[model samples]
Target: MTPQNTAGPLPPPTERRRLRQSRSLTHAQLAAQVGVGPSTLRAWESGRLVPHGSEGETYTRLLTTFAAEGVTAVDGPTAGEGASAVEAGRETPQAVVPQPLTPAQAFDELYAFCAPALVRQNYLLTGRPEVAREAVERAFQLAWQRWPEVARDRDPGGWVRAAAHDCALSHWHGFRSRYRRPEPPPADPADRALLDALLTLPPVYRRTLVLYDGVGLDLPETAAETEASTPAAANRLAYAREALAAQVPALAEPGELRRRLRPPATSEEVRAADPEPVRRKAERRNVFWTWAAVACTVTIIGATALAVRSAPTHYEAPIAPAQAVQGVPPAGVMGPLSREERALQAKLRSAAAKGPYRLVPEAR
Candidate 1:
């Protein structure tokens, strides 16, 4: 089925009226089927307003149902389809036509269509089915919360797919997975080996490979989503491809690798997957990291300030040269002694004369 473009405005009133008439149903009946008031239906028919959200979805589905059932009004002809009755010169009932799908319906259809592929991509990236399911669920929940932005996006599927991949690589995965039971490994030996090889690669390399090779994203796109430079992404892809070829030579071909890594289940099977707990956990982790960073910054600043405040200051002073001792003569000196030195020598001699043994001077 062709993917519906949900970003445009509603269909014209004349188109809506023609479809309703072709169904041979009154405006009130059609409105009831579409879960709207008769007046609302009239407004749509008169071009005063248009259906949006779920109402627009209802109109699309109801008209599609009519066209599939071949329901036609007793009128002459329907819209878009040529007037066959006029050519045949016969009066035949007008047939109802399909209306456009609304953004909400289109989003639902996109989720159902892309979820399985996204899950598989995540699974291949992380080597864990449970983690992949968690990732898909979280990505979808975020898409639902931001449907307006997502619907208008150029590649909504790529956006969600990238998000799912990130969720699979979240830092809290280890803590979150502990409480859950482990899923069984893939039955295929080649797949198992491929997954093992993929798991062994660094997260960036693995993600780049998956987005580029597995998901068929171009180098620039992969780089943009992975937040890496284009050159870096290309290098990573080359390394991952070479490593995978070396590890699992049997599945060296890109097509074979994608086939082996494709998701096994449909999105409907895991539609009930819960993402609230995971989202909450991620929020908590972010809060904790923020506070931790703040605490570290404050501690560094405080330590620097304390060190500057407590350091001691020092000053230098000059020292005078040592003075000669009063009774000691200068080394190697034959000159006469100074007045003070002579007086000291006479006192020493007087003391010596009074003692029993006089002191004798030794000549050098």
Candidate 2:
């Protein structure tokens, strides 16, 4: 359920910016804390939009904390005309209007917003910083490859997170020599123990625990991200928590368990590459594969055409094999002639030399 607003009306846009600056928080950091996109927070600070509902309450509370810390703007209205307007209880009816962003611009914003935390989460998922970096880069590459679908997604960050998690936990990595052996353990004993426990859990359970506890995703969101039923996800989370607590007794409490599920200090080494290079590499790969497919198709077509051109047009019968018979003489053997054949030959020889005469009547 959404919590009620106890922080009262928010100060004007200018004062909110001043308060945030005084606390030395980046837009990303503050937005993360307030459960909003950096762009939304920027809108709040610029007065193009106003915070309301649960988000408004959270923003007001955070600003109140800053104000309580003795950060104040001298020229801006703290309790002046701007505060009076807010106090007058006038609610702005305008929704958050997203500015038009080109594909490149939108992609860059998403990368900037999600990359750092993705690296950290992937590192926690896989104990190796190098592997974490590789998974995140690969995931972003895939995202760029399918940017049209990903950009249209309702939860783009969640989509990227799921991709990275799957990459990190892939069994295919076992075949590669680099990922065969385990990486070195974390330096601190507690971190090492926590990591060891996390690594021991089944991949699905580990992923569920991380999404729910480490990343602060609610049960339903965690289930949706992990592609599991809500009850199944809840059960996995329970089992994972029990196993982790067994390994590290200090993490018995739910709060403590969530706290310890962070990336170890070694995560400092895990850094994602610039988004520009990842996008470029994805495009290059897509182009290479496309040309390769076209070349294969052309080669097949040429081979088929050549075969048809050279093929014989008619069929010829094959000769039967020679067979041997007992009555037949062997090859190249001859038999003597019969007496009747010899007599006929002698008669023809004796009647030669024009001995037979024919009578013909002469014409008158």
Instruction: Return the top candidate by lDDT.
Output: 2
Per residue, candidate 2 scores C-alpha lDDT tens digits across 37-79 of 5667888899888787776789999998888976333444344
Per-residue alpha-carbon lDDT of model 1 for 1-364, expressed as tens digits?
4334253444566766777766545553465456555556777689676566666677766666655566444554575344666667676564466687776576666665677667777777776667778778778777866778977775677778778888989878777656256656667676677778988899989898877656555577679889999999988988888898998897678767655544352222333243445345545666787899999999999999999998867765669889866987668868989999999999997888788686667799
RMSD of 1: 16.5
**Per-prediction RMSD in angstroms?**
16.5, 10.1
- Candidate lDDT scores, in order, read 0.70, 0.80
Top candidate by TM-score: 2
Clashes of 2: 0
Tell me the deviation in Å of residue 96 in model 2: 15
What are the models' TM-scores? 0.48, 0.65
